[model samples]
Target: MALKAAAALDVELMSTGAFSIDQLMELAGLSVSQAVYRVHPPSAGRRILVACGPGNNGGDGLVAARHLSQYGYEPTVYYPKHNKNELYQRLSKQLEDLNVPFVNDFSKALADTDHVVDAVFGFSFSGEIREPFPAVIKALEETEIPVTSVDAPSSWSIEGGPPMSGVGSNFHPAVLVSLTAPKPLVKHFKGRHFIGGRFVAPSIAAKYDFEVPRYEGVDQVVEVMPGGKALVR
Candidate 1:
């Protein structure tokens, strides 16, 4: 459903060649923020560290930070400096308007946070972790706080057949907010065990001709199709 909407939008925008990537980034960010609120409602004060990247993923994080600020939660965003071009500049202006704090260092920011939101990398990512991204991943792994990945866990893969090797350490999120349709790689690589612990994909808009069931109060489970039974612990 989300894919359909995104594809439609992408095609429409590409046809005109006037639409900007920032718009898509904002949509993704808003979608993630809404999912977070649904899973964990905001209170008077709670600290959330949003780990963002230099690409569209970071832009989404910026959007989430701004919305989170509006809801009265203190959100600190960490991102590496890069020439993000005009789209990012626009996002930066928006973040500045919302007064969302941005940091280039992860150590200090991670030290003082209640929860971490992994907006660093998305489905489009491939290959090995490079530079500061690896450092950020390492820092996140060291933290005891719960982490919520926007789409899939960073450094994840679904290829290379069964008995997969070299998958990253399981940083089980208290909740994972998947946009549109869930990424196939996440389920393929991590299997049901990873997602069986608090995963959610929002309901796509009605115009899209599809709907995702409301996951509210739903139990997470792994199912075996042959017997048509759910795995229980």
Candidate 2:
């Protein structure tokens, strides 16, 4: 359902010349990084481990790693699978130019990091948890470190968590920034929930019956859920 709506929006936005997918991805990732900064402020020793997948979500992680480095946080990327897609290849090069290390060992990244950014999955993910992803997602869950998921938690259902396959392991995020609008899965999230992607036009919001939270002027992110009930302000 989320993917269908997203596809529709993409067609409308791109065909009407509002924006391209690349542009949207960049904006979304930038907002994700900004939310990460708000939740885990940059400090000398605070390092972030950004776990990325093979899809556009990984592109977002790479983008986040770049911005996090700019914000003074040491960020290492852990992208195990690589797609031949030119978009991802370009993003990888951008991260390389920024000198952000890509760790082959997930455990090593986890050991050296202070926080986790689970960009391993987005709203489009379905099916049973796969091999490497399951292992990696397990690591993210089993750890005591705080995690900040982009869009949605890895292995989570679009409408609810635990996945429709029943692989939920109490994956909790310290912060989540739902691009465009909060997904239904966010109802299960008990941490800080934010709405990003300031470019989402109000008309789209109305069409979707989306009561997108209003951020103070010029703000890129707005907290809609501090804990339980959604807040407008």
Best by TM-score: 2
lDDT of each: 0.60, 0.80
Tens-digit lDDT track of model 1 for 1-233: 23345457345443553445665566567666665564556762378888887776677777877777777788888878643588777777777787778887788888888777888776566667788887787776667776777666666532321123433454445555555444444344332212221222222234444334333344332222222233343
lDDT of 1 at 82: 49
Candidate 2: residue pairs that collide: none
lDDT of 2 by residue, 95-119 (tens): 8898889889998789888889999
Model 2 reaches what TM-score against the true structure? 0.91
Where in model 2 is the C-alpha error above 4 Å? 1-3, 164-166, 226-233
lDDT of 1 at 18: 49
Q: How far is candidate 1 from the true structure (C-alpha RMSD, Å)?
A: 7.1
- lDDT of prediction 1: 0.60
Residue 37, model 2: Cα distance from true site in angstroms: 0.7
Clashing pairs in 1: none
